[model samples]
Target: MNTRSLLHHFKEMKHYFIVVVLVFGFSFYLGWANSASFSHFLKDQLAGLETVSKTLSNKENPQVWFFIFIFLNNAIKSILIIFAGLLLGVWPLFMLVANGMILGYVLSLQTNENTLSIVMKGILPHGIIEIPVILIACAYGLKLGMLVWKMGVQLLVPPERRTASVEMKRILHLTKPLIVGMVVLLLIAAIIESTLTYWLVHL
Candidate 1:
């Protein structure tokens, strides 16, 4: 689809997108507020990520491997969450909460003096794109889940009240362009994360 078409679709789904963002924000707050409570679980999650980081860093062509790993991981997860929303949209929302909480917990670990530096150099470079892309994907997933839910509800209603199928088709069609756009943007984000962010953090 064309850029204008994609933008239009996004505009139409702004509410869903906003919902996804708000949930993440709230979840982040929860994580930050209850850092101690979440410490154990979050630490395990971070440890896994750290392991991956170490492995990637040890690779001969670490930068290239990092880019590939980051892109594939984000892209695949985002795509899966979107389709998985068919199960009442629970998975996508759960993922957002999990991710947001982890982020909050991580930031809570940073000292005040270095927090800004870490965010600016270690995250902002690629996160500006990656975060939004993930949110958009989740929004689409939530939308799909809602439609499926509506379809279930409409089973008892009259045929004339059944619009879920049409909306489902519309969303399915839009996914083509959405997936393409997400992949392209994620590629750019991964490159920046693997190269610029990595360099900045180490420097």
Candidate 2:
């Protein structure tokens, strides 16, 4: 897609993006406020993540392994969520809330002077890119979900009134560029997370 078309598509998706951001922010606040009650559940989740990290850290080239793992995990999930939006956009929305909660809970646990430093050094570098791309992917998924709902509703209307096909074509046209942009950006974010972010956190 040309820059103009891409920009237009994004403009069309601005509402969906705003919905995602709001939902994420609310969930993050909830998680932060209720961290004490959510401690056990969140700890289990964090422990599982730590296990995966440890296994990858033991690899011959841990940094490369980390990069590959992070990129694939994010790329595959982003693609899946877009399709899963066929289920009324449930998956992508759920993912956004869940991720936001986890981030909030993790930060809540950082009850130390180093909290700001950790966020700056460990998250900011990659997260600035990673978070926005993920949010955009979720917005696309939500838009697809809305389109699918319109498709269903159009069935009740006269055949001449149906615009679902046209909307679907627009989404299809944007899909190639969207996926390519998401994958490329996620790759770069993963590299930063695995290499520079790792070094800074350790230092």
Candidate 3:
């Protein structure tokens, strides 16, 4: 998309972005306040993920393989979140909250003096790009959910009054460029995460 179109799209989606941010903050608060209780629950929820993370962190895969893995993993997640918007946005919101809570819980666990530095080194390299991309995906998902709701509402009106097709076309128009941008950002994020992040953390 051109700069103007991109800017307009961002403005149009601002409310959805804010919703995700608010939910994230709330989830973080819950995780921080109930860390003792939530920790156990989150542990159970994330057991498989933890195992995979550990394996990845330990293995010294070639950069190309690591990039491919990271990119595909992120791409699938983004697609799932976007598609989940069809469920009236609940799925995307739930996923965002879950992820936020997990992040908060994990952060709460790091109590050592070097924790801040370690976390920064590990996250900052890729997080600056990845986090925003994920948020944008979630925002678009929420927008899609809203569009679906609007379409359903339009169906209740007379055939001449219905605008579902028009809405669908608008959605597709906005989504195509957003998805392309997200893929490009994710590619950069994966490269940074696999290389720069690794080096910084190991240093």
**What's the lDDT for all of these models?**
0.91, 0.87, 0.80
| Segments of candidate 2 deviating more than 4 angstroms | 1-3
- lDDT string for model 3 (1-203, tens) is 45458668788778888988898888977776778978878888789767766766666775656677788989789878987888898888888888788877877777777668856897778988988888888887888788789888888898888776676667667777777888999999999988998678777
Off by over 4 Å in 1: none
Q: Please provide TM-scores, in order, for all candidate models, with all chains considered together.
A: 0.96, 0.94, 0.87
After TM-score superposition, what is the CA distance of residue 119 in candidate 3 from its true location, in Å? 3.2
Q: Tens digit of lDDT per residue, candidate 2, span 131-155?
A: 9888888888888888889999999
Model 1 TM-score (2 dp): 0.96
Highest lDDT scorer:
1
The alpha-carbon deviation from the true structure for residue 15 of candidate 1, after best TM-score superposition, in angstroms, is 1.1
lDDT: the better of candidates 2 and 3: 2
Give candidate 3's whole-model lDDT. Answer: 0.80
